[model samples]
Target: MFFNRRTPQSAARPTGRLRLGTAAVAVLGLGVLTACGGGSGCSSEAPDSTTIKDLVVDVLAEPDSLDPFYRNTAEAQRYYRLVYSSLLQWNEDGTLAPDLAAELPEVSKDRLTWTVKLREGVTFHDGSALTAADVVHTIEQAKDPENGAVWLAAMSYVESATAQGDDTVVLKLSEPYAYLDGKLAMLPIISDEDDYKPNATYATTGNGSGPYALASLKRGDALTLERNEDYYGEPMKFETITFKVVPEDASRIARLTNGDSHIVPDLPTDQVELVTKRNANAVTVESNVSRLFAYPSMKADRPTSNTDFRLAIAYAVDRQRIVDQVYSGAGRPNSTYLTYGTLHHDEDLGLAFGAEPDLAKAKEHLAASGVELDRKFNIIAVNDPQVTSAATILQSNLKDLGIESTVESQDVAGFYANLVSGDYDLILFDAPASTSTGFAPDYVNGGLNSQAANNFAKFADAEMDDLLDVALTAQGEEAQAEAWRAVQQRDVETQGNIQLVVSQSSQAWSKQLVGYEPSALLWLNTLRDVT
Candidate 1:
């Protein structure tokens, strides 16, 4: 799931059901791979091996919930994807592909009606067959405002869903939405037998048609999964996979080095060398996940509401220094919200602000804003090491310009509360777009558009709204890309949110792990292909 910094609220009613296009017929196949090894401390020879049965993974935090509707954080979504299969799947290259659905839905000429064909022979973990009714039920729960689905706003265009037969499901939409397929790709389909009610407690186990079945869950300590023999798709290589929650970065790295854990995700940049030095078999995998920043456009009464003041903050940030010092050279400075390879990334638009800090220009813009320099502002961020470090750096930089600012570090939940309540002058946050959906209008619309549910910045502009409309409803990809480029250009000039850097998250795994691929989307289910 995308990283949302706000709490879930009552979702607005969807205008109509969203219709999307059919996917190609190609079914992805897995291939065996040659053994490869890397890391530094020990000799290059591979470690003595034993039969691979269980694969242990270390994560920073345990999932707050197993229920798809309640699990909003990226950490939770990683586990959710393993237990529940969606109608659509995102390929590593960011293309939408068929999952439980036999083929993509067929959209009507008006682009309002969509017919989806369910795959045959797929069974839930409980041995029940998947059907159109299950799809309908899952979608209904997701679209219902009472459910408070984290991604509810993305489905606001959907109006209704109906089961045509045991094998087919139909969707009706209010308007032509080009990215509807991508939005639906993230909706994990659950079985009708599952107790998935609005605002209910997280289910201890999941009943879905995925390759993995929940074996046991231990809340914040660990959760284990076993391969489902009756899965409809390719068989999982590992019989059991356990995700262990180790919140401390040092402990996580220690587990990987000590062979207690075979894989660890989100390894801090500063720990990369330590892990390699401790274990020769540890391999570091890096993927550019998102752009990190402090959004300052939340309240008009705040000094940041002034465009010049926001620009001053943008120009004042030494992005390279942040990347070097905070990330320890693990990330690259970025100016746009979208990642480098995503569609309509606007290379030129982000470059307008320049990569390096310009203190003189920042001072000039600050002077032009006419806000009182002595006014102290609050900078809020989650108490993560990197984020807080970056916040501290930003506070010091502002102080150098005779600007008074105070840093406030909060836990994840508290930080999200501050974000939704508009309680901070500068908010340190990050928004990651899935490779499949991030290339569309959803990223910008969610973060920058005036009425977007995730628009914590409270940015509103007529031209920005118009450009987004064009991008979402445009008839062709080229036209849509062009319109989105216009949106980026507008954002760069407006400085609604200053993107400090493109963040790169590191994943370290034992060299014995094979066929594992690091993904920008952070799909932990990719482990199914590993041996």
Candidate 2:
């Protein structure tokens, strides 16, 4: 299933001038160069050079589609961030900043209308000037339910967008949403001439207004992007950048070690030591992504439907142990759904499952639940190795609590179907909050509020809904924090969902590549500044 995608952290507006760093000496590895550098888009001729004009990056998978509105996968979002320009960009600290927008949006007194002024002189790759009309068209397309836009949740409150003039656009919302500005950062502004159908792949040929333009795409092999010379913002350093799909972790690391690829992202935790040993000079960065286990509350007949049973399950598992064993010490135990560094994360709320498992507490909660001793429930998970490992760990933990659970793994499509249908008692999945804004109202609403579209767990609490409403419309930071803290407390008390651990995502790049820094958002668009 397609999870929410992250964007780059906002930093000082990039000057776009290439800033090269010191190059690290290449170390030869023992393995003969395999599929990565042999015939898979990487050049084998230069095995130790660092001064290459063109850059080849190893991505885990090819994007499902180039159409921003059609796909929400990380791969698709990464490509979209590079090829398309949004009205606003996120600061490194998760604050909103203007990109295509000339300045901050002006909101009406009632908070229903937002007037946005577009930056002048910005042109798409096709050389058409970007105007309020383009923004209006993009919003209208996403707001249409028939389009099945992945980010439709963020704009559900948007009533309509109208262009007042060549450079100003006005948006009317059904209700006041405090996160509206932050949500708009994810809605990329596209060319008005571009037409994309729902679930259909759009062959992008340099049609965006971002730093890079699509040069060519060889599906399942490589995607070539050339620097957009007419880009209005900071100019890209590399004239050409090619993303090579290297599905295997070993192959991607090999490409980086052999100097065939400049960067490789989403490195497997198990392969971290191997990458470091092979290429000691490679630069590695890590950032945490939120992960959780959700119980299907709508399944009233299931044991997980009972709050006491859910709490019992929570107390049975050791989150820190899972972080160390399953994630190979590349994860942090999270108390709430939000990452630790996110805004409004309350340390006082403490760990929900505690530092370790409390078997006695688990037993007490289980006894109170009054579930049949012989009852058997299934824990469903996506067929990813890490997710499966986590599921197995939880399964073993529940067994110790005298509970029987069978772990079932399915592919992404099947897994999402089961979640939506509430066909399983428990589901181990990743539900990350928006990293760009570092906020949780949207996330809480999406996962816990009764009216949320993605509430696969079928969890509904009046207190949670009320707190979310207050948090979303609160005018000041203190008010918002208070509301969010209460919401977190209520989630813990009711056992809305058990947050297992926050996983650290790793990205490896050649030391020669500079001007790139890791952000919690994990957006690859920052590659535009790397030399």
Candidate 3:
């Protein structure tokens, strides 16, 4: 699952200059390196002229696809970071950093148009030259549903995506969108030619203006990549690398421990004790991955349709207990939907949830709503171990309040279908991202829309709609900030479907893995220099 929080294009009347990607480097508070130096399509601390070595990585879920546009999940986006390029990228601190684009965009006085300059000598993985035409075609294709740009569907404000020159791209908007940079940050550009597959498969085949190429593919097992010798930036550290899919969390950790693999993600929380005791030489870096337990606003008639009911559930939930029992205190607590460390969080928004269980208070709300005890509900979640565990915990928590709950586990295909079909009651919805530090186009009206936030659930607020309208039409940091703050307060205080919690992101790596950042985005191309 890729992290959300990208801003939308529709709000800004984004004419499609360059919508930024998820500026997640500022996770909830963190932030991309995509402006120029196309070597691996990643954000780098420093540039090196020397050759880099090759390394393989292991992850929990096999990448869903290699098609950059359709790949919106964190894992897919991370992979694209290595293989694709974008106008602007996010730094680790959630700042609006540059990537494929040479410099920051020039927004017009009216905020309806934006101009971006391309980095010098950047080329697609196909060795095709980069130009204004490529950018426009790629972006327009993204808006086309048939093109499979999941990230693009969320951005609707772009009225025109055009090229100002061979190296400059201009976007004209119907409105003013602040998160355009964030939106572009999430979408790494690819060739618009028909040589590539618009409908890619999980078989994992991809090529772009990135640092690596698809060297090999083996469905349900592994993927091998070859470094792009002509990469636009510093050459990668690795000559050859493999992405081994180890679905079992324990096995992934075991491979790292046995030195069979260099890196692995989604390591089991339960096994932390054993790994620390056994792999003293290994380094475990904890990251804040954003996730929210969405009751999906589907129950328009049920007690959950009420904001009070949602808050009660949020209040009743002992997030600390989950941290203690399920996560072992490896993660941090979250308040706003944005990740930790980012700006704009209401630091003073005290937790409605208290220490200790409050099933009585929970039941009282249900009683007042007349929803009745023993009301059966379904909690849908992706098949991650932690998610499953969380669902079970919710089951028990709701049960304590006299509600009968069942846990439903499904793969991504089934999960999305169920979510969109409105078949389930509650789901583990990964909220679109927008943190204290920033937002990309994908998270806002420009990217994946809250229609899911609403359709699956139907949360409608006149105030929020008004804020979005004003924010979309306004310009300048002051105006946008004021509107955005109102939006954040509303979501944080009441309509918070995307919750806040530092995620238990695990990376089991042996000493052999040197440069790879163990990210949910699964960025490995950036680790090419690893010996």
Top model by lDDT, which number? 1
lDDT of each: 0.67, 0.66, 0.56
The digit string of per-residue lDDT tens for model 3 on 1-531 reads 222223211112222222212223322211121112221222244323233254657766665667775545555655667777777765543356677888888889877888988888877766678888888887787776555466553345778988877988889887776556666766667666644456553236676777777888787787777888888777766677687878887677777677677666456545644654554122233223445456455445555666666655665566666656666654444444433423323333423344345777666655655554345777787777777776777777777766678888877767666555556667774431332123432243322134322233445566665665665555654665466566666665564463534444444454334343433132432253343
lDDT of predicted model 1: 0.67
lDDT, candidate 2, 83-180, per-residue tens: 88888876544356799999989999999999999989999988889999999888887777667566666777789999998999999988787678
True-vs-predicted CA distance for residue 193, candidate 2, Å? 3.9
Q: Model 3 segments beyond 4 Å from truth?
A: 1-54, 92-98, 144-148, 195-204, 269-287, 295-309, 332-335, 354-361, 368-375, 429-462, 469-482, 492-500, 515-531
Q: TM-scores of the models, in the given order?
A: 0.83, 0.80, 0.78
Per-residue accuracy of model 1 over 69-122 as CA lDDT, tens digit each: 764456777777877888887764445778988998899999999888989988
Give the lDDT of residue 91 in candidate 2: 55
Query: How many angstroms is residue 372 displaced in model 3 relative to the true structure, after the best TM-score fit?
Result: 4.6
Candidate 1: where are CA atoms >4 Å away? 1-50, 70-72, 121-129, 145-148, 191-207, 280-287, 364-370, 373-375, 431-441
Best of the two (1, 2) by TM-score = 1
Q: What is the lDDT for 193 in model 1?
A: 68
Query: Which of the two, 1 or 3, has more TM-score?
Result: 1
User: Whose TM-score is greatest here?
Assistant: 1
How much does candidate 2 score in TM-score?
A: 0.80
Q: Candidates ranked by TM-score, best first? A: 1, 2, 3
